[model samples]
Structures are given as structure tokens and as C-alpha cells.
Target: MLKLDHIVKDFGNHHGLRDVSVEFPANQTTVIVGPSGSGKTTLLRTIDFLEIPDSGRYQFDDLDYDLSKPLTKQEVLAARRKLGIVFQSYNLFPHLNVLANITEGPVQVLGKNKQEAEAEAHDLLKKVGLDDKADVYPDQLSGGQQQRIAIARMVAMAPEYMLFDEPTSALDPELEVEVLKVILELAKMKNSIVIVTHNMDFARGVADKIVFVEDGQIAYQGDPTTFFNEPNDRIKAFLAAGQFNVK
Candidate 1:
């Protein structure tokens, strides 16, 4: 299981996270939702070490780390091999084609052969509905297509845990669906997945557990059914403003 205890992130003027503690069980999809600047993204980033907390204890199965200190290069790389993250901006290599972008991590980081990596990349491309785009670069694809390719690239590494930080926030509503579809599919297949998104409809459909963050703290954490169907006043207000669908 993945767990955090009393995690705190200070940004001088404001706190990104304040005495936060949560657990993300294996084989469960956990979705984090909150209003803007409520530390939802910060919580996700901390899990993947994109942003180190000022004070906290992070534990993943056998490994444990004190978040008060910066991690060594080797420590970060070792941890990252088990964790994969996709940001809002699809950070593909402009110089490399889709196939190269997807194969790079497995070949370089995981020590897989070029041929094997390429073979898996092709299969992943097909999974994302973008097999034909393997020869194209990031600049050539649309926003949705690029995001889909980004997902494929991350999945190619086959991390034990997957993290997405507002992945569809940058796309148009139509384009957002394309990315969300791939993510939903991943949530179904992957063992551990955490997503931070504002789309209540997608969150309700995809998450096994829902975590509501408010003012740098977790306001609620429970099964998605109760989270959406039996919301408290604060959650009800959030749902009313958060593009929620009652049906």
C-alpha cells in the first residue's frame, strides 16, 4: 500500500499541503478533486516526488523516505522507475517520433533492448488508437492525439503506480473525452492509479475511491458511490459548480 503521514508542504507565503495523511491501496483507483489552488495537484506531485514536502513520511510497501530532506539522484530515479506521471502539458520530445518517444524510457532506464522496446511501443500505440501516428512527431498531432500518445509513452514503461495531474484540463471538451477514455481504460487495467481532475462525471465513473481536498487538506475520503450520491453540503455545493451529472 502507498501511504503518507502528516505531509506538509510550505511555500513561504502559503501552504500547499497542511498536515495531510492518506493511503492509496493497491489495485484501487483514487481520484482527487477540489477547487482551484486547493492543493490537489500538490498532493499528487508529492506522491510522485515532483514536489518534495517540507515535512512528512512517505511509505510504499517496503520503502520509506523522510520528505524533510531532498532525495539523492539514485533515490529519485529508483522511485520514479516504479511511479509514472503524466502532466497537463503533454511533454513529448519534439525531436523524436512517437515510437522513439515511447521506447526511450524502457530502453534507457529499464535496460530493455531497442527491438523489444519498439515492439512494445507499437502495441501500446495500437492500444491508444494511434498506431498510424508512430512515424509522426508531437508537433504534427492534435492536442487530444498528443495527450493520448503521452499516455502511451508513460504506459510503455509499465510502472507499478500511475499518476495523472489534471491531464485533460488543457484540452477542449471534445478533446478531453479522448484522453479521459484512455485514462479510464488504464484505471480498469492498472493496479494503482491516482488522478487529480475537476471533471466530476469522469471522476465518478472511473474512481473506486474519491478524495476531496479543500484548503490544503483532505475534506473527505470514501467510496465513490457515497461521495457522489450522498454528498454533504460542501460536496453538494462543489458538485453543483463542478460539472457534475446526477444521472
Candidate 2:
């Protein structure tokens, strides 16, 4: 459902990504794994349009995204609505409670009435196993709970695709499992999901395909089981070194 061609991004002296190209199928989970500084997060941001590419072609459905063209107000809004992003850090509002945080996008962006938004938020919270914490503030919730709330918040927006940037990176081991459960459940759904993570287990368990990035380029892309079980010498060496701490 999404295609990127020759995507390249550079930050002056730093190379974020180079000649990266890949396709993400609809209703399937695709995991991008790499060591730090390998451009995993940058690729996600570029796909979500948060980071403009220096040279590339990004096609979503029939629309071609031009990195150089300034986004119109409507175009920007529409493009953003097509995908939801969850950061490594829980980006919840300090002031908003779980319910409010989840409903804010629907109420404001989609222009749904507060009552309608709340109903949708309630259902989404329940889906993420956060229904009981709807009234709780983010600070009051554990990291896992907060992350689930973040997931609910994004799901409430009903985006066409979801981009998760190491959703479990900041959590404790216990909390990581809690967040992973929600993600695993999401992976079962009929929505496209692209995750940037070093968690090898999670990728093997949930990903339909895996893409390994190294030195700002796609080093490997194939069936997760095949890649994980019979990785090439370079990948095997990298995995052996535990360079990215894949666990």
C-alpha cells in the first residue's frame, strides 16, 4: 500500500538514510531493525512525512508525495490523518487524562462532538486494555499504561497505517511486555503497521516481513523466519555481536 523509491536523507555532515527503498504491504506488520544510527527512526519519520527527504519518491495509494512541494493546509492535514505515529517516548499531554488524550484528535481533527469522541475513545481504551484507567492522568499511570493509552489515542484517530518507533524501548521489562501485548493485538488487526525496533523477538513474533538497515541502507529484506534463521554472514556477524542488542 506504500512504496518508497530511492529515499535519501542527510543532515549536513550526518547521513540519516541513503538510497533506501522498500514497499510496505497493507494489513501486515513490517518491522525495521537496525543498530543505533542505522536510520531506522529516520525512515519511519520520512514515511510519515515528519521528515522531508532530500531526494526520494514516496507514493501512498494514488497520491505521489513531493518532498519539495510545500504542503497545503488541507493536504498536510489529510496526509497526517492517513497515518498515526507512536514515539519511543510517551508523548502524552501532561494535563489531559487518558480519555481526554485519546479523544482530542477525533474531537478536534475529525470535528466529532465531545460525546461522540468520548464514546469512541472508551471503546479504543478498552481495546488496549486501558478502559479502567480512562479517568487517570498520564503521570498517575505506569509506563505501560501510559503507552497503552498512547496506542489507544492513535487508534482512536482511525488512521490507514500506524508507525511505531520503538514503542517498548523506554519501558521496564515488565512494562515492555504489557505494551507488546497491545502491539501484538494490533498486529492481528487488518491495518498496516511499520515498527522500528531492535526487539528481535517481537519482530519475529509479529512481523510479516523484516527489513534490516545498516549504514543507512537496507541490508536485507525478506521473510522474518528465513532472515532470522539463515541470515547472511554479515548479518550473522552483526547479530552475533549483538550490536543492536536485539532481544
Candidate 3:
């Protein structure tokens, strides 16, 4: 299980997270939703240690961290190996072909032989429906295709937990669905996944638990059905203003 307690991140003038605490259960998909600049992304980043918090206690399986203190390089790396994150941008190496990009981590970090890595990369490419594009460069692929490749690359590492921060926010509606489909498949495949997104429909359909954030704090956290069907006044207003077609 992944857990956080009294997490706080101050950006000098404002707080990115205000004593926020939440638990993400193993093998469950947790979807985080909030308005723009509500610190939802900040919260997600903190989990991966990309944006270390000012103060808090974080527990990832048996590893524990004191957010107020700096973590050793080895500690950070050990924790990161168990988690994988995909961002809004595909962030693929433009210079490398898709297969090479996917194999790089496994070969360099995990010490897998090139032959083994390439074979696994080919299998992952097939899994993401990009088996034919392995020889192509990132620039040659469409935005949706590159994002799918990004997912494939992450899957190649076989992280115990997958983290997605607005993974499809930059793509068109149709393309966004393409990435969401892969995410749904990962969730069903029993990976512990945490996603920060604004897509209400996807969240409603995929989330086992919904966490609502506003003003750098959790406004609500519970079942998706209750979050949508029996929304409180604040959530009701947010849904109406955001124009989410929840029904």
C-alpha cells in the first residue's frame, strides 16, 4: 500500500499541498480530480518524489520516507523502481527508434541483455498495438501513437505501480480515448494505478476510488458512484461549472 500523512509543500508564497493525507490501496485504481492549479498534479508528483514535499511521512510498501529531510540517491532510486509515471508530453527520445527507446531503461538500468530487452520490447510493442512502429522514430508517429509508445515503454519496466499525470491532456478527443483505453487495460491487468485527470467520463468508468481536491486539500474521497450520483454542494457546483457529462 502507498500512504501519505500530513504532507505539505510550500512554494514560498503559497502551499502546494496543505497537510494532505491519503492512502492508495494496492491493486486499486485511484483517480484524482480537481480544478486547474488545485495542487492535484503537485500531489501526484510528490508520490514519485519528483516534487518532494516540505514535510510529511510517506510509506511505499516497506520503504518509509521523511519528506522534510532529503532522501539519499539510492533511496529515491529504489522507490522509483517500484513506480512508473507518464506525463502529458510523450517525452520520447526523438533521436531513437521506438524499440530502442523502450529497451533503453531495461538494458541500462535493469541490466537486461540487449537481446532479452529487444525481445521484451517487441512483445510490449504488440501489447500496445505498435508492433509495426518499433523501427520508426517518435517524430514520425502521431501524437496518439507516441503516447501509446510511451505507455508501452513504461510497461516494459514492469513497475508495481503506474502513475499518470494528465497523460492524454495534450491530445485530441479521439486521441485521448486511445491513451485512456490503454490505461483501462492496465487497470484491469491488476496494476496499482494513480491518475490525475479532468476527464470525468474516464474517471467515472475507471476509478475504484475518487479523490476530489480543491484549495490544496482533499474535498472528498470515496466511491465513484457516490462522488457523482450524490455529490455534495461543492462537487455539484464543480460538476455544473466544469460541464462534465457524468450521466
Candidate 4:
């Protein structure tokens, strides 16, 4: 399980995160949904140590971190490895082929040989339904295929948590389903998966829990059944404004 208490972060011009607290159960999908600039991305970054919080405490499985003090570079990197972050952009090495991109981290960072890493990469490619695209470069694939490659790269890292920052937001509307399908498969892998997304329909389909954030804070957190069927006025307003088309 992952737990956060009193997370606080301040950007130069904004409250990046504000006294945020939440818990994520193991082997479950937790979707953080809200408007743009609502601190959903910031919260995920802090958990992965991309953004340092001014104050907070996080418990990830057996590891616990105090965010009140500064963390060293090594400490930050270590934390990041525990929770792999996949962003809006695929961020694959465009110069490299899909197999190379997926195996890069394992060979370089995880101390695995090319053969071993390639084996893992092949398995992940097959898992993401892209086994045939192993030799293709990022430019040769569609947006959704590129995103799946990015996800496969993270799976090779073997992290306990996968932090996704709008993984499908960059794709064309028609291309979104392909990426969402891979995400749904990841959620079923029995790891704690946290995603920040505007895709309400995808969230409802996969998330065991949903969190609504606004103004740098979590306005609500509940099971999907409650969040969709019986939301507070705040959530109702948000859903109405976005016309999320929840079903």
C-alpha cells in the first residue's frame, strides 16, 4: 500500500500541491481526475520525486520518506526507480528502435546484459500487443503505439508503482482507445497504478478508486460506484463542465 500525509508544495507562482493526503491500496488502479492545473500532475511528480514537496510523508510498501527535508540526488533517483513515471509524451529515444528503447534502462541502470534485457523487452512487447513492432522506430509508429512502447519500457524497470501523467492525452481521439487498452492491461498486472487523466470514461472502466482534485487539493476520494453515481455538488459541477460522458 501507498500512503501520503500532509503533502505540500509551492511553485513560484502557484500552490503546486496543498496539504494533500491520500492512500492507495495495493494491486489496484487509482485514477486522479480533475481540470488542468488542479495539481494532479504535481502530486504524481512528488510521489516519484520529480518535484520535491515542502512537507509530507509517504509510505510505499516498506519504504517511508519524510518530505519536510531535502532529499539528495541519489535518494531522489532511488525513489524514482521504485515508481516509474510515464508522461504525456511517449519520451522514447526516437533514434532507437522499439526493442532498444525498451531494453535501455535494464541494460544500463539495472545491470542486466543485453540478452537478458532483450528477453524481458520481448515479453513486454508481446504483453502490450506490439511484438511485431519490435524493430520499428518511434517515428514509424502511431501515437498510441509509441505510448505502448513507453509503457513497455517502464514495465522492464519492474517498479512497484507506475505513475502515469495523462498517458492518453496526447493521442488523437480515435487513437486514445488503443493506449487505454494497454493501460487497462497494466492495471490488471497487480501493481499499484496511479494515473492522472481527463478521460473520465477510461477511469470508470478501470479504476477501483477515483480521486477528484481542485485548487491543489483532493476534493474527493471514493470507490468508483460512489464517485459516479452519487457525487457531491463539486464533482457534479466538474462533470457537468467537462461533460465527461461517464457511463
Best by TM-score: 3
- For each candidate, the alpha-carbon lDDT, in order, equals 0.91, 0.86, 0.92, 0.88
The sequence of per-residue lDDT tens digits that candidate 3 reaches over residues 1-247 is 9999999999998989998999998899999999999999999998898988889999999999897898889988888999999999999999999999999999999999999999999998888889999899999999999999999999889898899999999999999988899999999987899999989889988999999999999999889999999898889888878787544
lDDT of 2 by residue, 1-247 (tens): 8899888899998888899999999999999988789888999898877877888777888667765556666765666779999998899999998898988899888899999999988888888877898888999999888888888889888889999999999998899999998999999975799999877778889999999998889999879877778788877777767643333
Q: Model 1, range 41-75, lDDT digits (tens) per residue?
A: 99999988888899989898777888887788877
TM-score of each: 0.96, 0.94, 0.97, 0.95
Stretches of model 3 off by over 4 angstroms after superposition = none
Task: Give the C-alpha miss distance for residue 83 in model 2, angstroms.
Answer: 0.6
Candidate 2 residue spans exceeding 4 A from truth: 68-75, 243-247
Q: Using TM-score, rank the candidates from best to worst.
A: 3, 1, 4, 2
Question: How does model 4 fare in lDDT?
Answer: 0.88
lDDT of 4 by residue, 127-185 (tens): 88999999989999999999989999998999888889999888898888988888898
- The TM-score obtained by model 2 is 0.94
Clashing pairs in 2: none
lDDT of 2 at 233: 81
Candidate 4, TM-score vs. the true structure?
0.95
Deviation (Å) of 52 in candidate 4: 0.5
lDDT of 2: 0.86
Q: Candidate 3, TM-score vs. the true structure?
A: 0.97
